[model samples]
Target: MIFYGKQNVNKVDIEAVVSVLQSDFLTQGPAIEKFEQYVAKYCGAKYAVAVTNATSALHIACLAAGLKKGDILWTTPITFTASANCGRYCGADIDFVDIDKKTYNISVEELEEKLINTDVKPKVVVPVHFTGQSCDMEKMYRLAKQYNFKIIEDASHAIGGEYKGHKVGCCEFSDMVVFSFHPVKIVTTGEGGMVLTNNKDLYDKLILYRSHGITRNQDLMTKKSDGPWYYQQIDLGFNYRMTDIQAALGYSQMQRIDEFVTKRRYLVNRYNDLLKDLPLILPYQIDEANSSWHLYVVKIDFNKVNKAKVDIFKEMKNKGVCLNLHYIPVHTQPYYQSLGFKQGDFPNSEAYYKEVFTLPLYYDLSYEEQDYIVQCLKEVLE
Candidate 1:
C-alpha cells in the first residue's frame, strides 16, 4: 500500500548514522553543533538550538518569549495540539483564531480584528505554516509591531519552504521559528527538532533550556568555578537535548533538503494537473511563497457526492491507497473540550476536518504509484 507520507533514507543517511556510532561522543557532541550550524546556515538564521522534537522546541520558544500565567497565547486551531499545548506548558492562557479557507493558515484578517477588539493582548502569536505553505507572515509581522506581541512561527511543516523569497526559518517576520525532523516530515533525524532565531538572548536561553538549565560556561554561571569541573542550574529547564546520532542523521538529511523539496513540488504539480477534473478543491499556492509540499490535501465536495468522507476513505484504503487526514480541529479534541472549547468555536477548522485528507507524498513516491492512487480515488468518488 502507498503511504500518505514517508522518509527517504538513502545509503548516505545510514553511513552518517554509522559514523556517529563509531565516534567518541554519542550525545551532546560535535555532531549536535554541526547539525545546528547546518540548519542555521541553510535557513539564514544567526543561531539554532537542536532538540529532541518539535514539541520541546515549541515549549522552549514559548518560555523564551516570556509566556507565563495571565498571558494569552493565540494560535490557529487547525494545527496539531503541540502548537497550543506549548503555551499551556508555560502556564499561559491559550486561545485560537480560525484559519483562512484557502491557505489553511491563520486568518490574518481575523487575527487583526481579534487583536483590536480583545481586551487582553496576546504575549505571543504562533502562525503555523500548514501543509508547508507559509502564512502571510509579513502582514502578521506588521500587526505584531503595531500591537507589541512576539511572533513564533510554527514552521514544523516548512523547513525548505520560502516565504516572500526568504527561507521560512530565517526569523525575518517572527521572533522565533521551530522545525521538525520526524520520520514523515520533509527531513528526518529519527526524531529531532530545531529552534531558529536571530536574537542572541533567545539563542542563549534556548541552549540553557534544552539541557536542564545547566551552564558550564563561566560567563553564564553566577559565580566562578572552584575547579575545572563546575556547573550550575541557572533556571528550570528540561532534558530536551538531541543526541549526536540523531544530529548526524539530520545533518545528512540536510544535504538533500533542496532535492527533497524539488521532488515533492513536482508531485504536487502533477497532482494538481491530474486531479483538476475531480470534485475536489486542490491546494493553492500564493505567488510570494514556494512551499516544501510536505502534504498534498484535497477537500472533497461532500455535497456533490452521495458517500461520506469516511466511506470514501474506507473505499480508497480497500483499494490499497493508505490515505489519512492531516488533523482534527485541535479545539474539538476531548482535552480542549474540557477547557470550554467546542465544535463550533472555530468554524473554518471544523469545516476543514470534515472534508480534507492527505494523499501519498514523499521523495520516493513513483509516478506509477501516484497514477494508481489517483485512479483509486476517482473510482472511490464515483
Candidate 2:
C-alpha cells in the first residue's frame, strides 16, 4: 500500500551510521557536535542543540525561553499536540490561536486582535509551519516586539522551506526554530530534532536543558570544582540528547536536503495539475513562503462530494492508497477538553479538521505511483 509519507535513505546515510558505530563514542560525542554545526551553518543560525526528537526539542526550547508556572503559552490548535504539550511541560497554561483560513498557519491578524482584547498575555507564541509552509513570520515578529512575547517557531515541518528568500531555520524572525528528523519528515535521523538560535544565552540554556542540566564548564558552576572531573547540576533539565549514530545519519541526510525538497515540490506541482478539477482544495501557496511540501493535504468539499469521509477512506485503502489526517484539533482532545477547552472553543481548527486529509508525498514516490494514488482518490470522490 502507498504510504502518506516515507523516508528515503541512501547508501551514504547507511555508511555514515556504520562509521559512527565503528568510532569511539556513540552518544554525546564529536559526531553530535558535527551534526549540530552542519545544521546551524546550513540554516545560518549561530548555534544549534540536537536532541532525541522534536517533542524534546520543543520542551527544552520552552524551558530555555523562561516559560514557567502561571505563564501563558499560545499556539495554533491545528498542530500535533507536541506544539502545545511543550508549553505544558514547563508548567505553563496552554491556549490556542485559531489558524488562518487560507494559509492555515497562525493568523497574525487574529493574534494581534487577541493581544489587544485579552486580559492575559502569552509569554511565548509558537507558530507552527504547517505542511512545511511558513507563517507570515515578519508580521508575527513585529507583533512580538510590540507585545513583548517570545516567538519560538515550531518549524517541525519546514527544515528545507524558505520565507522571503531566507531559510526557515535561520532564526531571523523568531527567537528559536525547531526541526524534526522523524522517519517521515523531510530528513531522517531515525529519531532526532534540533533547536536553532542566534542568542548565546538561550543557546547555553538549551544546551544545559538537553542533558540533565549538568554543567562541566567551570564558569557556569556555583563554586569551583574539586578537580577537572567535577560538575554541577545548574538547572532542572531532562535527558534529551541525540546519539552519535543518529547525528551521523542526520549529517549525511543534510547533504541531500535540497534534492529531497525539490522532488517533493515536483510531486506537489504535478498533484496541483492532476487534481485541480476535483471537488478538492489543493494546498495553497503564498508568495512570501516557498514550502518544502512535507505534506500534500487537500480539503474535500463535502458539499460537492456525495461520499462520507470514512467511506472514502475505506475505498481508497481498499484500492491500495493510504490517506491520513494531518491532525485533530488539539483543544477538542479529551485532555485539553478537561482543561475547560470545549468543542466550539476554536471554530476554524475544528472546521478544518473535518475535511482535510494528507495525500502521498515523499522523496521517492514515483510518478507512476502518484498517478495511481490520484486515480484512486478520483474514483473514491467522484
lDDT of each: 0.93, 0.94
Flag clash pairs in model 2: none
Tens digit of per-residue lDDT, candidate 2, span 46-87: 999999999999999999999999999999999999999999
Please tell me which predicted candidate would have the highest lDDT against the true structure.
2
Error of 2 at 173 (Å): 0.7
lDDT of candidate 1 over 299-382, digit per residue (tens)? 998777788888888998888888889788889889889988987889999899988999999999999998998899888888
- TM-scores for all candidates? 0.99, 0.99
Candidate 1's C-alpha runs over 4 A off are none
